[model samples]
Target chain A: MISKEEAAQEAGWIERCQRGEQEAFAPLVERYRSAVFRVVYRVVRRRDEVEDIVQEVFIKAFTAIRSYNFQSSFQTWLSRIALNHCYDYLRRVRASHVTYFWQMSEEGQRNLEATAESREPGGLNAEQRAAVRELASQVLEAAPPADRVLLALKEIEGHSVEEIGEILDLKPSTVKVRLHRARKRLLKEVSSRARVRPGEPAGAPRP
Target chain B: MRCDHVLEILAEGDPRAREIKEHLAQCPACAARARAWRLAQAGFRELASEPVPEASVGFTPRLMRRLAESSRPAPAEQSFFEKVGRRFVYSTLMLALLALLALAVPRSGPLRSPNSAELMLMQPSVATLQDESVLNVDGLGSHWPHNSTVTAPAAGGQR
Candidate 1:
């Protein structure tokens, strides 16, 4: 983890870069690349596009580094840059008629579809597995956009609440509440589809 | 405590542990609920644990190159204005320090003049009377015509 003081010191390199001291920026890049890559990978998901997005994130960060006030850690600031790029890419993808599933290699697409199909909870028998897989795909297709994003970040990417908050610009408490609600909604959908009786809801209403 | 409340705490952990311990001391029903919630949470945790894919091998170098390219200096040389700006900042800072020192030090003192006679005359109680005849000898003395005795005002009088 980069400390506030360390980030501040690195900011001096940005000032140098602004003055045309290009070499000063190498260490800054080395320190923050992994943090930035993790954010981009979480959103974009595709291996090929991850590099392009990561590159774009650094370019954006370099162009805007002067405006950074050092209020947050450089890692947090870099994460925001990567996240914004990922969201922009997602939005662009959504606006176009292109389907991400279609863009993937056949094997990749098959694996992803397989995962989606078998997402149902509880151990299932052979017949039940097939039925549950079919139903899981339908439920996922029906899930809200925000819920899907939350699930991808929390469950698929395995991000901690604090990390998600930094990436999403949400408070930790808010992230927890949203994640808890997202899981409950997914659970409710699965339970409803299974026609299985729920013992009780997972958690109480958040104050 | 309500089962709902106990379940919420159990979902989060230690907070629910303490709550359950206290509730169990009195209410067996809520305590039982806590135990069930804990078991469920543990099971969910196990199911949720999946290995994330490793970051691609070339990611670091590719990122570094991108960052390097973005931070690269312009092909054109530094303009005269930029050079002047840097010098201006340094000069301004140095000048400010000098200005501060000038303001802090006492300006009036014996080091400023070779003659000590004026300093001796400025003593609080000393009254030096210069004869007008000495001024007449030193110069044509056209201003001493009225022979008025000019004396320093007494202490505390406005000059």
Candidate 2:
């Protein structure tokens, strides 16, 4: 697979693809598949669904490639497709009533607990582990869908704010404000939960 | 400005670091708020960063194969009118250019002759001389061209 930078350097490939040279698009697919997968996986959570969503994102990207102005990085463009697919999937799930928001919240909590249990053998003390688990669950639960998407792209996926803005079709200032708000909300939730729980000391060092 | 600047700078800090430093700061009210916000942020961040289960082992190969299939060339087709329309446009443009050039080029053909009435009408000064002579003479005999034929009429009488 070609590196994204190298694939991007082949400016002629986009033009060729626009001219209906489908073969010219393989390098683009190879370069962006992982990034697209990461975005979809972060939003959808299920491995099987992520695979399907990632494929759909690429297919959509190819079909719409002619309209792409190359104004943003290809990866940014691909991420938008991935994010939109996730949102669509979420909406479908909501409509079907397979899982409501509250149910997902409980599921997320359980997942956090499971993760915390798995992390117990990593030499962390009981109090530290509890704090970590608490913090993780609170952050996940409090973030809105858009904020969750941004957090995934910016923090976990390690995309720059500029890239995130391109993907979300927002200004960098907007992305920054949302990220700050998201972080602030998560912080408040975790700290309040910590104060109420008696097992851990208030000032316990983070694991 | 002081509080705003501090808060602005502090907003960019990692949640854990931000909270610890904010608590140590003198502003108890702001520090408490910052701590709360940071804790909430940390919680959310942790959940968001949870690793996904590894994809099925054959996933990459399958994806690559599908990508390869999608990139394969399909048949190409162009309609008859599409081809004709293109040629028509090209020929029309060429013809227009040729017509314009033909008009622009110098020519050596004979200059077309003028009609007799046109030649006479074009010399108004010549027509005026006849009018001036008629006014000066009381009889037409003075200016008439003759070979012993008709007599001229007097100014006031018919002859």
Candidate 3:
């Protein structure tokens, strides 16, 4: 829960920044930089792009400081800017390369399918987990910006529906519905595209 | 095959991945569901780590430089009010200078010299005076019988 004192302090800083005190805004940036950076990196897995994206997010927030509404926490406002930048970057990449969400080489697809159909019937080990992460990096970017962002925030960032609604300007019910749809798309697409293994029962779970 | 249940499991991310796997073993539809969710969760976990990075020593300085730069306006850019004020000052000075030169410059033209000897020539001529009198040339009241064409009003007055 946000306290009244913290809110007042943030308001004071905002007022000062709006009044042209550049240094007064530093504390605010220092306070939220890590949180903002994390959100950017969660969606943008490229190490090279992540830092630039994070910098861009902060710069945008800085430029638009006067328009920030005090009703929402400063963090949420900053997050909206960060996620939008990530979407723009994702869109630009998609437009330039015509990358699809499920594009993978035959060997890559086989490895993903093999990982999904591991014979252990046990928990995913470290290597399997790493492979899954690698596959996610590709698929998440290839997926629709809205879907990947929703999934990243819900599953990866662990934001509640209410928080996401405020961040994305969506209703709570809408957030829930969109979140489900995004997960459904990822799960369904991955399952349908994964190749069947040799000598595996057609209807079985690759056991 | 309850898609709702599978969706809930994926969203919830609980009951231990192993327990979910055990349940998936008997349920074919859910097995596939679990497979997808398991892959998704692995990625989620991998990506979620270190949500924020530690700020580098140079980071805040770079940010300060940016903030400082942002507060400073571009060399070529100016506000609307500034442009209007500059233009207003320039226009006002130009008009004032024109008025001052108008007063300081000598009025030596023939029209400006009202007391000059050429003022007599500037007066109306006898012909113009006769034109003003239709039936009286120089007030003699001579209505000539041969001048029938001068019955209408003078067209020269219209010019």
Q: Report the number of the highest-lDDT candidate.
A: 3
DockQ (C-alpha based) per candidate is 0.03, 0.09, 0.19
What is residue A169's positional error in candidate 3, in angstroms? 1.9
| Candidate 1: tens digits of C-alpha lDDT, residues A1-207 | 667788678878867866656467677777777666665664455667776777788778777877666677777778777776776776677667443331224543343233323323244344443443344333433455556556556654567788878767889999888877765566555444433323322232213
Q: Across residues B1-159, which tens digit of lDDT does each residue of candidate 3 receive?
A: 343665576467656556555555556666666666666666667777634555567876787787676667744455666788899999999999999878754343244333321323453233322354443422333545533444233322322
TM-score of 1: 0.46
| lDDT (C-alpha) at residue B20 in model 3 | 55
Q: In candidate 2, which residue ranges exceed 4 Å CA deviation?
A: A1-5, A8-13, A21-23, A94-138, A191-207, B1-11, B14-159
| Candidate 3: segments with Cα more than 4 A from true spot | A1-7, A98-115, A118-122, A192-207, B1-5, B13-30, B50-55, B74-159
Alpha-carbon local distance difference test for all models: 0.55, 0.57, 0.69
Better of 2 and 3 by lDDT: 3
Per-residue error for A148 in candidate 3, Å, reads 1.5
Candidate 1 CAPRI classification by DockQ? incorrect
Better of 1 and 2 by lDDT: 2
Q: Lowest-scoring 10 consecutive residues by lDDT in candidate 3 chain A?
A: A194-203
The collision pairs in model 1 are none
User: Of the candidates numbered 1 and 3, which has the greater TM-score value?
Assistant: 3
